[model samples]
Target: MMLEYLPLAVVAIVGVPLALAALTRRGDRALTRLALALFDGWVADRGRRQRERRELLYEVHLEDTYRMYASKTLLYAGLVALAGSVVGVYLAAGVLALFKISPETVRATLPQQLWFLADLLVFPDLSLGELFTLLAFSSATLGVAGGAITYWIRWENLSYRANARARQIDESIARTVAFFYALSRSGMAFPEIMRSLARNRSVYGETAEEVAVAVKSMDYAGLDMLSAIERLADRTPSQKFREFTDNLASVLQSGQSIPAYLDDQYERYREDAEAEQEAFLELLATLAEAYVSVFVVAPLLFITILVIMGLMAIGRTLPLLRVIAYFAVPLANVGFIIYLDSITESLRATREAREIDAAPGLLAGVRRTDDPDADRTGTERPAVEGSAVRSDGGERPAADSSAGLAFERLAAFERVRWLRDLLSNPARTLRENPVYVLYATVPLGVLSVVLRAWPHLVAGTLTVETLDDFVVQAALVVVGSFAVVQELHRRRIDAIEAAVPDFLDRLASVNEAGMSIVESLERVADTELGALDAEVERLRTDMAWGVEARTALYRLEDRIDAPVITRVTTLLGNAMHASSDLARVLRIAADEAQDTRRLKRKRRQEMVTYVVIIYLAFVVFLVIIGSLNSILIPSLPTGAAAPDTGGAISGGPLAGISEVDVEAYTLLFFHTALVQALFSGLVAGQMGETSVKNGAKHAAVMLAIAYAVFLLLP
Candidate 1:
């Protein structure tokens, strides 16, 4: 009887050996080898034949298929077969049980009994043996088909994952090859570079794995460098990486200077990356416009229409329309939200691309360069042109003799009395050049006054609100002018701060070259370095013009107000008065300035996280409020509340409150919008180091969001 359902019989017989084979193979090399051999000879052969005949289009690679089946296919197939057999046996027993047949009778007729039960389960009214026989045959066929389909789906998924991993590996290899090329230019010997890279493999991702393979090939198998690299490239599936390796091999064979070649390549890459970033930024600007249109303008237009319709039917249709408006507005907002999310993700990708483009330059700057001989000497000789100079007679002096003449000229130029006179009196300088200050502050003051007065003028209350308007307008003008003045002052301070470090470094260099502090300053002041030169000239002029050094530095500090300048002036002032270590003090000031700049950069970076968090929090708030108003609130019974007229309660649970004033809520919404704008401005200022005025753009966006949400609400 079991022979009648031979597919089922086969399953039952093979199931145990498959399960035993799986258990035996674990920690048993003999069993594993046997399984692998069988899979290769049988299963893989079948797959190949099937592929050849085009019976299967997505053919699994023979090696991969062999590995999969040998490791777990047997156990899985056995489980499938065992499950089918158990089901079949249960059906047959149930059939026999239903028939009121004795166990002795069924013992002699297991297949007939199972067939009867299968028939009963499949078709309850059917005759016992006929239905069972048909069902048993169908069950056996179905069980095999189901198992095959499951395995096929699983295998396809595995293949997909493997392909993805291979692509990732390829990209990793390309990046690693580029890195090694860069390192080679840094004067690292080929083998030493490889060794160092291999030691820090984890940082390079999957390329590290390839490096391990190459190291093994060379160290253990005695393969040469070319063979090892070629083998590694072959093992990797990345076209870019293969091209890089081949190029390297060509270079190695041609005996070209690797550093020069790498430098050229790096420059080319940098240009390409910058061009890509420019294109991306252009794309981002377009995307930003699209986002603004979809999320801001479109939503606002819809809300405006809804508001107009509500106002038109203020006495009659508004109650029902308001309820409908709540639901409709929020549902419409979903489209805007989806658009925003898409735009945000696109922006994130663009940002990542920018970072990636910047990475090579950053790495190049930090990477050790090829200058071992220079490093050992502790001093590098200047180029011939840099050492040569023109004498007073306009003839070029020999490089070895021009240093003293340069110093003398520098000292004479530094003694300009007018420069020091100017530094000691910045107010006089500004009063004399009032055009720059007037050009900056006048427009800001006028704009502020106009904006503050426009509201009163629009209401046709110029006469009645004269005092109030005047106060507001005057306040606006004062604040605006103050802000502009502060910005201008800050710019000047920044210019001074930027020049201080370089100036100090140069001064130290000249001092170390055996010049006195005064001579070093005098030398540097006369150089044509613009702001630094001007500042140093001012100091020398102060000394020449009979202004005390202490008074002159204090005047410089008062004009600039940068911390670095303040410290520099204090140190120089103290040294001038107290005979302190002026050189040591100048060095300390330079170090402090550098440290401060570093800290500022670090603080800005840290604040970026907070800025991001604030933006995300706002987005989350919008989404939550949107979801509640659109989906949940509208679903509630009270959501259908009718608009209130003069003291009448109309619809839903909030009928009483409906008659009460909602002017407070309206005011709250407007204030919330303003608050959102304020924080957005703050966030922009903290993260971007932009002026609060520039932050108005971000503030405008946040305000638009808040206003849109308020207008969209029921």
Candidate 2:
């Protein structure tokens, strides 16, 4: 009977997802609509506490209402449970057909002790009641499992997003404070400064993201600035952000001097950011020691003891060592990498992108009042207004110039121009994102692996131990190339950022010397500002092409994508709108950049020692593994050469002596070193440079040593 419904099941399987996918083309809101239609009665209405809790949860990061987004999440969970139930039924049928247990057939060969077990599981025939019971049990079990999985995912995803934002906010808040403080100094109102920050989320990261919600509430919900600030405090996940906003709300509510408060906050947060970075560096040092002791020393001891136990025939432990070397160690290394990344999150820079104006571009239709060019072109008085008045009391827009169409064309090209430039020059593209190097390296690495591996496969000699050398070599090839290129990219950015403070100081000096911004740029462009000189020239070129100074600075930010650079550009760009004393703003930006660089340089110097310790620890780990494989194992007594004495020593221990598999132990040790090399390098990179990508060279060197040591081993 169920077989008759199988085709319908198949159709439902295909159609439901296809229908959902069709809804996606309408935008994300389409799902919200569909989910509400299906589940609004249950999900939309909630108790007061749930409404409040989920309101806080859904507002900031998700940018959606609890009613809509919650409904969508619940609906997805139910669909997954439904699908799981269908799968359970099908699996129940499969089990019944495949197992088809019978008591008599097993009873003759089975013991009386196991009779109850056979009787319990045996199904003489697939009766209706029996089928229904089995299907119901399986369906209930799996349906609950699926529902739990989806529910966990929903909460986990929300929490992860919240935590990520918290991290981003903590990392970028110092710079964000400086940004608004600069605005305040420029005589911009606090409300306008908040609006500016909201509009520039790309530059400020999660700080701006939080403020953007408040700006929206102000726009759409008719909330005052103080109300929005309070709401922001309530909604933010970061404790730091909450405290900052709470204080800001207090300042706004009280009738205090906002600029003075902001200036003090900016200086305080800058020092706090530095202090926090120092703490992070200390944490990295601690993690480095922990990694070495756990991954290096601990494994060395365990492998040594396991080899000794196998030699004495106390336990057959070759496979255990193999599992430790090949499976457990590498997995733990990856975990360490994730741990490094999470801990370093508070220290990393945010480089998120935000869009600015692309409308009514440089090609605006402005008919000059006394233009000789328009007169020569026979169009002396083309209406520059969006519309023109006609005698019939109807509006007649200019037929001669379509500024909107021109702006649209320019915007269309601007979107793809970066892609075109990337295609035109592959090197710059790779430099922009080192991961792109994998596009070329992966294929080459794979081909080399296949060439080496194909021979082993044909000879029926393929095994992990045999292929370890080849696989690690391929990893080295792939990872080494990426690391080299990644380092180059990092260094390029570093060199450019290093010059930023000097460049800003020089620009300030020139501005204070009475040159206009353009004149200052021309003046500074004549004297080299190191790697930044070229970028300043680019900015100058963009301005020469009639771009606004603010937009040109924004372009410079977009291109540089550095930490201090983003803050500086955002500060300069927004300050120009609110103040005439740009020289003061420039000096402030330069000081901020200089302080950030100073902190980073100190952190780098401190971590260099930890990085060296990691390398030395890794070497010590290898030497221990090497000594065990060579001297200790080779020196141990084999069962074949055990003393034939009837003494207590021989009777208790030597009597159980057995020959160890030296070949397997050596292979495991070799592979263990490789795994250590791979992850230790990543840890070292994270410690020294605050990036795992910087670890590639370290990993390559470790891998080379392991390969050479193993090749020379018996």
lDDT by residue for model 1 (340-383), tens: 34322211101000000001211111112133311111112222
- The TM-score values for the models, in the order shown, are 0.34, 0.72
lDDT of 1 at 692: 43
**Residue clash pairs of candidate 1:** 92-114, 95-117, 115-132
Kindly give the stretch of ten consecutive residues in candidate 2 with the minimal lDDT sum.
370-379
Which one wins on TM-score? 2
Estimate the TM-score for candidate 1: 0.34
- Model 2: per-residue lDDT, tens digit, 1-714? 998678448748744653764477554667678778988888646688566548547434665677776787787788777777877887888777755757776666444445676676665676788779989999888877997898778766777777777877888888888887788887888888888787667667778889888988898999998998998898888899899899989988999987788788888888888788877777777787888889888888888888777776665788898889888888888888887787665455554434433222364222222322111111133354567789999988665456556555665887798789879998888887888888889999889889999999999999877687778778878988898889889999899979988998999999998888877877888887888877898888876766667666766876776778877876787787776567878888998889878887998899888888988998888888888888887776665765655576454544445555667777778878888988888888877877888888898888888778877866
Candidate 2: how large is its RMSD? 8.4
